[model samples]
Target: MDSFSHAFIIAIPLLLAGNAVLVPFAVIGAVIPDIDGVFFLFPDDEPSRYIFTHGGITHSIAGASLLSLVAFIGLYLLSGISWFSRFFPEGVTMMAGLAILAGAMLHILIDYLAYPGIPLFWPFSTEKFTLGIFPGPSLMILILSLGLLTLILTGRAGVRHYKTYLILCLVIFFIYAGIALYANTETEGRAIPTMDPTRWITIVETDECFVVRPYDILYGRGEEISYRKYTNITPDELAGIARLPQVQRLCYHSYIVTAERRGDTVILRDPLREEKVFRYPLDHSSLVIPLQETRSGPLPKNTDRP
Candidate 1:
């Protein structure tokens, strides 16, 4: 989910529980998982410092906990200050810690549902996991946001009445979640036969691709500023492609990785990391690597990746 989605999702409980004072802390906590991205301010894609400073550590489950603790302490301190007392309905309380923890946890869970996955049990394992619910943002966030807004505007979400809306919101989330997952499965089923994919279980579009966003199939093109297919690799060639260092690195960072062979060189790409080509969804400093795969094995062909 994006930060706005995270913010809205975290706001629900805070608003309904009549502790709207915690909403600010919760919203910040939801985005804390991505806070490390701040380092990206100074040439974020610098290979030497890339993984060490960004998503690598902060997106982890353990990272969220540590972030929550820090947030709790910060919120606790702010709760003590009398300056901001006028803003919060009841000022602040120690329970804001719980709100921060919940928001951060949801952030990790939401990311877990997407591709290239997250390192939840980092240090213990580097394995990634994902439900692939949708390649981009999920619809659950939008529905909840709209519904919550409607209730708030109609004056139906007062202290006692807000609980009813909250319950409805959760029900709507579960239903939409089921439909979204099912829709992805359906799209994958259709794409496999039509796309003529290299992998049996999945289909990686060539040249052009469509993503499974909330309620629609979104058309996407690489950052060529125009759509172009730069490479094409045969099925038998994938083994050699996977062994390439660039492909491995791309796979490590992406939830969905695909390949294309450009004559003598192999091109490894992550459709989820489309920004390397399109620059949307915030680039995250991705680089496309070209590979020279031979019958013996794969070798790095590009001395310049960045």
Candidate 2:
């Protein structure tokens, strides 16, 4: 979710509860997890730095707690300042810290629902878990959030109606989630939501290939859009390639990856992004490694057997 949507969605509950004092703090917390986005400004060539990338450790439970702790301390110290206390008479309290923590957790929850999910247990485990119910970037969400924000800014929507607005947002999210969940059940593999709520992309993995197709909640699954075939690299050779530092970093961020042998090198890429099903920019890009560098020598074309 975008920062705007994250702020508004988190603020709704606080507003409804009349905890207006915590709303600003919570909103700040909501966007704090995204601070890792600054990593994107620099090249991610170092495999050791993967944990610092967007949607990496910061999105994890441990990372969130650490961030919330730092943020809480900052808020606490700021509240002690006489000038700062004048504006926020309530000052920082335990409840304020909890509110910030809650906002950060909510941010993680929202991202978990979207594509190429977060590693909730990062540092401990790099495996990413995603419901794949919502598209990475939803035009619908952006427009609705912006419109609602406009109303609040213009004083057209009063605080009294916050509950009603929250209900509407929940309804829309659930409807989309419900459809995607049902579609996933009917399919063999995962169902990835598209920009259009009604449509989805399904990926069914096989021993040698991954079958990708479009699906519709109202109708049914459509024709195959992509068939990513795995390179016929030997188990030992493939294991060595997987062990490569660069490939390990890519695996940390991508849910599914496909390897293609090209001359003396093997290219690793996320099939979803490679197929353009997930249109949003990804944290990891394709990686190419020379085959001679693996434990085994250059592989024979289309033959894994020694």
Candidate 3:
């Protein structure tokens, strides 16, 4: 889950718990798991470091629990000091604890529905559990948007208390997510017109940008391309790629290309960067007609000889 969803989960609970004053802080704590995104700000030496995956430490149950404990202890301890004690107030210590716990639990809950599951019981166990609620890229945005809107409308119009709103929103989120998941399952084997894996090019159309990913080898159409939250290539790999005349001339402006490993060799391709895109893997071997005639036709072929 991204920051917006994270905030929604946490804030909804806190608001419902009658901790409206702490909603903003709860939102901030919920987003702590995504601090890995800060890696994008600095330049790296190789492509491997560029967000290999998300939801490792911060999205773990340990992280969320630690956040709850910190909020509880820090405020409790600070309550002793007069100048730093206003946040705790007189009768709100229990409310604050409940708020923190609610926020932390909600954070983990939202992440469970994402592709790479969060460690719901980290330190105790490191297993990842995913509900696979939505596909990467476009489907995620659609799902999250619907969830957020439902939460807002139902919470505001129907519920009188924050707790009621929180439960209602969670209910709506799960129901809507279930429907979206069913829809994605239905489309798994369906043909997507613009995407053909046999061709060297991958097309990603969004509201803001249209991305095209191309295979740069002498004759290799990129294999098994999927839309993912994190990219395999780091800033260093992107810079190295930019120096290549073939990539610069053909792909730099169209798509953001990167390399990932299969067995030993690294294959070049464009990744589905955001959670708002869809991936379609084309099977070139299944094609009866030449690839050059369709939408993403005339792709480069793998020419490395044995």
Candidate 4:
């Protein structure tokens, strides 16, 4: 799941346990597990600090348990209360620590369904156990966490008033996903033409692509910018495109430049551009042709994204 969704999922339990004031702390606790992956910020760099070690520690059940125990002990001693009394009679710190541990544990559990699974019982075994489904583990986290949050919040009478908002959010999200899926699918789902790391561009049918501005919220959707059929390019040109350093850096494993044929020339369109760029005599697979480039401007239409 996205960060917002992950945080919301962790915050819900804290919200249920404490009031609004504790939500931030709970979110911090939840995000602590992921802090080990700090190298994510410098994805291209090797031997980055915080990547080699500390990844599974905070994310593991054992690590969270240790933190929880430490919190319990620290709270008891700081408050100068008997252990039983601290836990039973006035268990503020203990409960708070448990909330933190719960957040971390939940983070691990969510990552299990992700591509590279987390070690629930670390130190027992170093082997990773993943669900091996989607490559984008964050996406699974986003959907499930948000869904659970919606379900939990829906069950509460006080939050019932916001049910319409939640439903609206879901509807809008699927609408965008539907369009994005359509764009990618219709275009043959190639890596080069369809994948957008920034998610600003979504492939529609061949020769057509839609630009969608991403959202910042858990279930928020983006607005689509439709780029109508423009020009056609040949497979050789697409292959040449795959050789480019920029495209290689961006899409990587999921690159595909799909072309649709028309009349004597194979027309290729730049889905990201406003003007049409054409490619002629689309055949002769050995010939490598350069794709045309164009400038972009403000969209002709306006729509809400975030």
Between candidates 1 and 2, which one is better according to TM-score? Answer: 2
Against the true structure, what is each candidate's TM-score?
0.56, 0.87, 0.45, 0.38
> What's model 1's overall lDDT?
0.55
lDDT of each: 0.55, 0.75, 0.46, 0.42
Report the C-alpha lDDT of model 3 over 209-249, residue by residue, as the tens digit: 33445432235434434443123433333333333333322
Model 1 TM-score, all chains together: 0.56
Best by lDDT: 2
Model 2: per-residue Cα lDDT at residue 158: 74
Model 4, span 209-270: residue lDDT tens: 44333332234435644444324633343443443333322221111222444544333323
Residue by residue across 21-115, what tens digits does model 2's lDDT show? 99988997898999998988988778867677777789999898899999999989988888887766888889889989999999999888887
Q: Candidate 2, which segments miss by more than 4 Å at Cα?
A: 225-229, 253-255, 282-284, 295-306
Q: Kindly provide the TM-score of model 3 when superposed on the true structure, using C-alpha atoms.
A: 0.45
TM-score comparison, 3 vs 4, better candidate: 3
Poorly placed runs, candidate 4 (over 4 Å)? 13-22, 39-55, 67-92, 140-306
- Point to the candidate with the largest TM-score: 2
Which scores better on TM-score, 1 or 4?
1
Better of 3 and 4 by lDDT: 3
Q: How many residue pairs clash per model?
A: 5, 0, 13, 17
